[model samples]
Target: MYTVMIVDDEPKLRLGLQTLIPWQELGYEIMGTAANGNEALRVDEEQIPDVILVDIRMPGMDGLQLLQEIRRRGWDTHAIVLSGYADFEYARQALQYGVEGYLLKPVNKEELSALLQKLHQQISADRLEKQVHQDAKSPEWAVYSLLSGSHDLANVSIDNLAKSLGMDWPKYQIVLISFPGLHPEEDERIRSFRERLVTAYAADGQSLVLYFAPYTVLLLANTLVGDFGRADLYRELQMLSGEIRTHMDVAAGETVLALDQITNSFRTARSLLERSFFYDKGRVLTLETPESYRQAPSSSKDTSLLDGEEVSFRLYYLVDVGHAEGIHSLLDEVAAQMAIIGKGETEIRERFFYLANETLRKVSPRLWSESIYPGEPAQFLAGIYSQRFIRDLVGYVTAVMERLARCADYTSRDNEMRRLLDFIERHYYENLRLEMLAGLFNYSSSYLGQLFKSHTGEYFNAYLDRVRIDKAKELLTQGLKVYEVAEKVGYSNVNYFHNKFKKLEGQSPSSYQKKS
Candidate 1:
């Protein structure tokens, strides 16, 4: 089936386009939707839809401008314009620019289906013509064959392919450009970029460029044996990588080998690129980073033993009661302990997975499936997984919890209020304020204060002060000076700290310290 992309500024119109037609029956699949012309360009790169249905007007580069850009870039994708009015001028321009179809807004189902059917027929005929005219006699095609594992060097004439690119060398290297999050799109711009890189290298002598993956481009460069050390070649590749990054945001890695070592150099280079997933700071990779580094320092602490069931139960309860702060506290506590057990990707993921699964099983069972995991459950997991560092993971998990908390309908308000008291106990020393806590836990400050008094027999500020003062008392017992103890427990003003301590402990700072 031919893929179709929808581009319109109006979300309702985009939704209508998505659901209005019998797209599947018309031999079309909805590839993706974009809000405006600029977004359509990016989505086009990722989707490469067979046909694009775009509204005539949009903010920042209208549909006409976008179609012009597509044509300028020589993208083979087709365009269908959506016009709000029967403006002959716009229709004339669209036709002049080779738009396949133009339809009025609030599209009719039959007309939309007919246009798709016609496009599919045209695409089929064009496919036949393109196939008949296709040629594979290029060095890029040869390198693609190698990278794709389609033609092994033992069975293929590498020398001929190398000669095709005017290269005959005793040593070679493969440099890989990798885009981690980019959606894969087939476009001539990428092909042309590869060709440009080949031309740049060819100026000196020998290089072949090929599209390896949707997000990867490989450049194979040949050199005379002993002409340059591997280090020198790697340095050059690093410079090229920097140059490429200036033009496009991508991480790059490289592997150098003797001419005879092309057998697995490409694979090795690609594997080297995977290092970017763990070590994101430095983009260039000359050697494989050890697998052990994939994990943070291993810890003897076991996260699962940290009462997985109890924690999961609490998390589910908090989510159900809409206790946002409680959920955040629980996730933070769990994640902190998990990090102590070694920040290994698998260990962290598995530990969090246990917590997530246990909680999800109770909260949202359908989220566990791979088919729809990309929803909330999957997004939460993906958000956590994408984090390269444990610190980032903590922030991401907390953010997800906050979002889940916002969705709480608050059926059990009293239960949430009780959880808020517990939250204050855990976070009182961290500059915990009633306003912030109220927002975090999805309650108004006035209601939060009333609930605090109801649950804990004290106002929100009074309870927070007691919690801090109690913590300060412990530090005092440990022989810390009064002012030091006060700062350690979140009190900033010494005078206010003294007043609260005097009121709670019935003594001034000097008296409390002297007694301790």
Candidate 2:
């Protein structure tokens, strides 16, 4: 309920105004009353009411002075001026003070009720606008949410989202944006700038949603009206980039897209973002068509090197020995062999893209996107374009491999850490406390704690909790009942399980199950 305050020198007038009006029906609570402006200001500071009714003519600080103080303090209270005098000059002064309405002395009940109704309508509209903005950041509402990772809405029904937005499926256009060389702070600034532009454009009936990621922002807008042409959109985007560059030195690129092909547009935008290394800085490159910007083939040979058992064995040998340089060299050799078989750089790139995607599909199917390459897929065959993004990926794979290798090492010194991890993973569903694991492994609990940390880089208890949580996630995803999942994950106490799940997953077990 919204709080309301009354300020009048006359006690009877204040009481009549308070008691005559059905404040509860009008969506307001009479929070406080004051006999002077100073008292009103004090209550306002303490209570911060949503609406304030003040007498215009008063001793010391008058209603107008109180209104000025409120404005100076940036308070959002809606003010209504009340006075015995209905002079035109008084009403004009109230208007100048940002008063929502003016009431003559002995205020009419009908007039007050009408004003309350109007305020209610305005508040409701504001709430609807906010809800709409939030919806735009979810898959059910905006395509931009997909590229920016703002929402894991891959499973959301698009038809439901369209219905909520009052948009036809074919009426939307997706614009994928990329910002290179942006730090977290710079990314925030750029995001704010883009939101402002979207707000301005939306004033003309264009609905827009902005989604931000580490290095990119995506915009999804309903452009079915065709009021704004493609060239106009491009010009506005260029202007926005120029404004951003004035504040921060960075390169921003965008790719406009039709609704049905948003996933492809996102890939095109990402590829363009990466290409900034090869181009001039602070350029707003737009991928109107990906086919037109295809690169020339690499000078690698064409040969089916992977088809030979000897080559396969040698490649695996290099990888097994932790020779990253050797693995890269072997890949280069394979690329060269393929070039010799009359395969252009484009052809080799296409083959490698297919191979890499297929490998990832098997191991991490959840991360795969339907639109792997944008524009014309054939154009992506020029070279393995995603090589630059593989550094972190390779490092991760190497770490996992190193951990597994340590588990397989012949030395007893390192075997304890591996054994602890293996034991935890295998027996997370049992009441396997730290002391139990320590005794089973023939080590003191304190010594085992230090060993686990030195090996896994995490505390023993934390590691165990992580293992249990991961197992719980797997069980929950398989449609286990909440209580059953709790028991299966070794948490016999349902309350404890729910609390732990919430603490780790940021949601309750039931909520996570519903979402999955």
C-alpha positional error of residue 498 in candidate 2 after TM-score superposition, expressed in Å: 98
TM-score of each: 0.39, 0.29
Off by over 4 Å in 1: 1-135, 151-164, 181-196, 199-202, 220-263, 271-276, 285-287, 290-391, 398-516
- Candidate 1 scores a C-alpha RMSD against the true structure in Å of 18.4
Q: Which candidate leads in lDDT?
A: 1
lDDT per residue for candidate 2 within 235-262, as digits (tens), equals: 5666666545532222223333344355
- The residue-by-residue lDDT of candidate 1 on 235-298, one tens digit each, is 5544554434432223323434444356466666666555343343333444543332344334
**Total clashing pairs in model 2:** 15
Itemize residue pairs with steric clashes in candidate 1.
Answer: none
What range of 10 consecutive residues in model 2 has the weakest lDDT sum?
362-371
